[model samples]
Target: MRISTFLLVLILLTSCSEKDKHPYTFYYWKTKLALDQEEKKALDKATAPYLYTRFFDINKVNGRFQPVAVITENKSFDTDKQIVPTVFITNQTFLNISKEEIQFLAENIHHLIEKKIKEYHLNAGQEIQIDCDWTAGTRDDYFSFLKQLKKISHKGVSCTLRLHQVKDKALMGIPPVEKVYLMCYSTSSPLENSDKNSILDVNILKSYLSKLEDYPIKKIEVALPIYSWGIVTNHLGKHKLINALSQNDLKNPNFKKVSDHEIEILKDGFYFGNYLNKGFMIKVEEITNDQLRDVITFLDKKIPEFTIIYYQLDAKFVINQNFKLISKFQGDF
Candidate 1:
């Protein structure tokens, strides 16, 4: 009888844990400017009662998340950051990374993190997500890299993938890993007529999402651009990035203008041979705020596994909202 009681209690505990392990959506902060400790705290407070993922603006590495200190160290910036109990996705620009480089890159990442965890004695809470945006053409190499990456990832580390990569892939082969976060940005690119002025068309988005029906939808989190979307290019000539969408053209006077092909560029962003693609730009619409909630609802119906997380709360858009509208849709915040 005592044994039976203990077994029942254990079962109850297990059940409780599973229930608590909810798929969460995070309002992630992405910027090249590192937040000071005080700023981090303020940001944390702003995003409280919801899981917040913070990206340290370190754009130096390939196939790996740049450690928080990479950017902070340069300025002697110190953040006594008790990173909130949430996912922290380090951006690893891996498109240029080659297959042979994968294993070596993963090792460097593993050691850096292992050393940090030991140094800080930090509990990064549940998971660490890696943000990589390699294109479909390089998907196989990416999979190979992750396979090797899993071998090196320290305990409690998982990857955050863009929606396209997760399609036609297996996430579990990476060892000692759990969960995958899905990013749903990059629905369309711009035509060459304008420097940067692409539209996030509803039709384009729906079509892209339709292809990902097989991905593990539950562990998904969409990363939305919170700031006004801007495109920077160099007219494919100068090395420096110029504005793709002109700030002068926005609905606000402060907003710039795009090329004369404004309407066509917004509707379709591709270029023909005569025009040639130079730059494409756009500012994501305010409508997407409500659209996010709607998208989540729609996705939830098709696949019960979606963990809907807002990409960021500290982004300019979130801060600029009218309070009355926010209160009405409490879920957006």
Candidate 2:
């Protein structure tokens, strides 16, 4: 009875100060999964101890023409933040979203945002952030797209730009981007005995980042991969193609389920011959201590103000890190 009474009092105190005032945290969902009640509880329990220490949530909105919010994640929303939440639309194919499309999506998104806020009985936060990875070649078009997004979105709408691999001297002047996310990972696999010149390209990226010294560091974020991926190719499909695949050269997924004919085709050297002796093997890459240190060391010196965003909540490839000391990230061995 005493415990229950104390809990009620605690809840009342917490209810009085739910809205938080601080920089928001933006997290991208690598894959769409329907969140469940148990899972939601698990998450709340996991982050409960942190409380206002990390007070923000980034609900990623992904898809093409469908304009779908397919990720229906369940959360306690009992966060220290009073803001409803923020959204980051992740896509870059369209040269322009067009005023018409922005106008259309805004209508639907507003209601969704409102419903979540009401369901949680909390004040929804201001602004929507779109995530686009475009290049200088399409500078004009990208700006045009941002204009459309800003115009149609609620009053304080903004966007995030994915800076995976950029030239040191790509842009002359700072354009309009709420935050520029430097993505330091490859869609492919990591190479062995590499100095990580390909991913973060430390020396090159640092030189280019120097030019952006005038830009707002608060708006800069770095995409550090907590995940790893090896290469997986369909030998059967590649057989009819021009370029053959080298198995040993790339990390291959387990293929016990692969067809025998595919293996035979691979053996013939038409596809996946880069690896020796039916050597089609996959090399799984993770956030090794050396790789993490390499990235942290570079970013600490190059772009210190940028927030380090964990790519997703969890990916088969991502490392679930909680301790800050794990600057040298550790994952499945």
Candidate 3:
């Protein structure tokens, strides 16, 4: 009788551990919402339980905050998986807003999000996530807006927590949200020389984790980057932004591969997203499988309860990855 009772208690403990395991969430951040065959196949293979889809971006235009919608024509998002409509707000939008104005802005944005969710026939109330890199100046207004948003939202609210913000929480103040999604990538500066690995530098990220022990928020969801981009620079060595093009695309005669990181433009013309004279440079930045593993291991040791969220669900990033390794960091694995 004593042996049987002990086995039963062990089984119950194991079951509870399994129940508390965090679910993996993918972020679908494309301006268009339609999933291609490749993306759909990747999603099916991923088996992620949730998707954080970017609904729109809030930008300050003509001194007024406006929601620039990312309208979707196709509504083929998987119904089996939970959907969280994510809103990306520019920090500048909250810089000059009053408390009352912030409240009104929150109300309008929430309504627009609901309208989009209804149009897409997507499930609501799992919880909505907000992505914003708020600065010291805009922290109060932004936090106030979050407070107002939570009051109106039936579901809970989540905010993107940057590394700098995490380190300087005392100065920036805690955002009024239920869950905070800590973005672990983009730790290095883009304007720095090509030597700096901005995507996932373990050295830079470790310093920021020490402060998490004192952070009041218990619930944290971590978003790690699986995507890569190219920083384009002109002849004058000024930095420009461009989506990463395939190696084959850069193989054209107009682009001379000076080095693995440096691409010297052979022709003076418009390219990628910026107009360039000859001798322009494009530096490719990416997170490797090893780097991903390192970050995951470091985070697991420091904050084991944090949920794992891949930056995106697109095939371009997911296809080449060893997700089994990435998911292993989660307790569910």
In what order do the candidates fall by TM-score, top score first? 3, 1, 2
- Candidate 3 achieves a global lDDT of 0.77
- 159-182: candidate 1 lDDT, tens digit per residue: 566544554355322222356655
lDDT (CA) per prediction: 0.44, 0.43, 0.77
List ranges where model 3 is wrong by over 4 Å: 1-22, 246-259, 266-277, 329-333
Task: Give the winner by lDDT.
Answer: 3
1-333: candidate 3 lDDT, tens digit per residue: 999999999999987665445446678888777877777766665545677888999999988877786658475655456778899999889888988888888888889888888888886566888899999999988888888898887668889999999899889889988689999888887876657767777778889876676778878878888887777776566786665554545666888887775678888887765777777777777777777767776776666765678888777777666665565644321
Each candidate: RMSD: 10.0, 11.6, 3.8
User: Which residue ranges in model 2 land beyond 4 Å of their true spot?
Assistant: 1-64, 74-93, 96-102, 105-124, 144-152, 164-175, 187-218, 233-279, 315-322, 327-333
RMSD of 2: 11.6
Our tally of clashes for model 3 stands at: 0
If ranked by lDDT, best first, what sequence of candidates would result? 3, 1, 2
Residues 105-201, candidate 2: write the lDDT tens digits: 5565555555654555554445554555546554555566555556555445455444432442346223465655566655322333333423334
Model 2, residue 32: what's the lDDT?
Answer: 35
